[model samples]
Target: MTSAPPRVLTVAGSDSGGGAGIQADLKAMLANGVHGMSVLTAITAQNSLGVQGAWELPAEQVEAQFRSVVDDIGVDAVKTGMLASADMVRVVAALLRTLPPEVPVVVDPVAVSKHGDALLGAEAMEAVRSEVVPLATVLTPNLTELGPVAGVELRTVQDRELAAKILLDAGASWVLVKGGHDGGDTAVDVLHGPGTRQEFSAPRADNRHTHGTGCTLASTIASYLARGYDVPSAVGAAKQYISGAIANGFALGGGIGPVDHAWQFRGSGQ
Candidate 1:
């Protein structure tokens, strides 16, 4: 008989393109040997190129979905993305408070997509910064996402580190500042927190089909966290996973395609 797998729950949106949102989160979780579960908060009409349209689910439905899962199977770790509205963020935050503090929580404060499409609304910003982020064990934000939270411009590597610090100060126990979008020969991602700050640099992959990198990385970290890895180790492993995924990214539907989530399965399409 097969043994049970680690359970990682993702509360996010769906991307029709399968590059980002819940699709990417589940792929990352399953790719890392975890049982993937979901509570979808929204759905996007998206493709490789861009998000054409998005609609958020009612807050009641979001809460019901969360209750359905957490009240039963339970989650080893919980990851959130694209709450979409202030009311939804508040609802999720309240639900998180009801969970035992030992359950790891990863909050991917997703603000915009790689293609510059707005995912979260302006009203949700205050809710996220005040209510949701404080409840997170870790917060993942790209450089572009840092500008709004850090309350400063992040045009350089130093700025990226500072942004991570600012996010940590606000509430997150840990902050991962993704630098994949930063233009350079080498890509740098930073993780900052209480005791120390570490930086990782990998040679930039010249791959345009690198959609979903951020979501994949955050969920990968949450997957690792669910499996009992420490914060630093989980972040390091997730960084390696995302970098490799970017290198092996494959083309899909029209527009920028998604990174190969099952990179380890290779071209076999497992």
Candidate 2:
């Protein structure tokens, strides 16, 4: 009998479009050679164009799913996304606090969708800053999310660095400030942790169908962490993976589509 691979669980919402949220996380984990599990927090009526509607699951239900996975399956690492309410965020954070210190948690502060649909509101964002950020081993926030989460406006690279530092001081062991929305010739992401700062740059892919980029990157990092990679190494590898995924993004609906989570498996005849 073969041994089971590393286990990575995602606590997030369901994207009916199968592009972002829990769908993307599971796909990225599988592509990265981990056993993927999920605890669905909400359900979104979403597509390439935008999110039509979203309904958060009850806190009790969310907690039940999480305990079901962790108490038995036992996650090696965890990734969180699209926590729709302050109550839900608190519930997830409380559950995370129960995990052993060695278990890495990747928190993706998902505030808005690719097409400008709000997934989390002001109260929920505040809860994430106070409750979720402190428990995260890695806090992954894109450019638009940085200013709000850190309570500052980001205008330059130094501002981004400052925002990352604010998040680090808030208690996340590492903060990955993604520059995908920065609209430059190159996509640069800054990873800042204690006594360490690294810049990862990739040529900006000219693909309009680049949805799910953030969730995929964070999930890939958690997957690598589950596989025993250090924080910097895992984030670096995830950056490479997401870059390829972005380059291979293909059109689906009228608006933006999704990154190719299985881009590595392309042409493999699987």
Candidate 3:
């Protein structure tokens, strides 16, 4: 028989909107050819418009869920997003530390949602920096997440590089500072790591249905990492995948829609 697909896990919140959070993560993982699993940290009553309500699971529940999956199934790679509280962050970080170092971890510091809802609390900021971020094999931070995460002002690409250094100092092996918020014809992201710095640029997709881009990108990277790609290679391929998803994003709710996770299969009419 053919080998089984790589197993990837996402430890994050649940998005009822089905656009971002755990929903988007699983979809992206499947699109990238990985077996996806999840451990929900919070539940959000959300839609394309905004997050109407949210409730975080207790630390004990979060810990239990993580142990259940990781102890039994075992994952090749993992991605984290939308940890609602400081306690949750601490628990997840502690568990990650115990995992085999070979398993790559992609941490998406999801502080805010696409509709401007606060997914992570202010109190959790320090936990993210001190607890969560340090365990990341690849840390993916968007423009909004960069300043708060690194505690520095970011404007130009140079500024992001500086902020990346701060995160690097915090112990993340690699950092990808996403520049999709910047004004330009092309979207640029800088990956900063040991002895090398690289930039990945793609044409900006002019679609409003680009919700969940960050989640999709991070999850896709984790999926690739599960399939045995190195940090740079995983990030590069994931960027290409998300670019297509963004370009193919179609309208759904009254506000922004979601990036099509199945964009790769759509053009062929499959």
Expressed as tens digits, the lDDT of each residue in 137-244 for candidate 1 is 888888777777566787776777777777788889988787777788999887787887888788998888888888898899999999999999999889888888
Model 2 whole-model lDDT (C-alpha atoms): 0.93
Global lDDT of each candidate? 0.86, 0.93, 0.91
Model 3 clash pairs?
none
lDDT of 3 at 32: 96
Ranking according to lDDT, highest score first? 2, 3, 1
Clashes of 1: 3
TM-score of each: 0.95, 0.97, 0.97
Query: Which candidate should be chosen as best, given lDDT against the real structure?
Result: 2
What is the number of backbone collisions in each predicted candidate, taken in the order shown?
A: 3, 0, 0
**Order of all candidates by TM-score, from best down to worst?**
2, 3, 1
Q: Give the TM-score of candidate 3.
A: 0.97
**Tens-digit lDDT string for candidate 3 (169-220):** 9999999989888888899988989977999999997888989999999999
In model 1, where do residues sit more than 4 Å from their true spots?
155-158, 267-270
Better of 2 and 3 by lDDT: 2
| Deviating ranges (above 4 Å) for candidate 3 | 268-270
Measured by TM-score, the strongest candidate is 2
Q: Which regions of candidate 2 fall more than 4 Å away from where they truly are?
A: 268-270
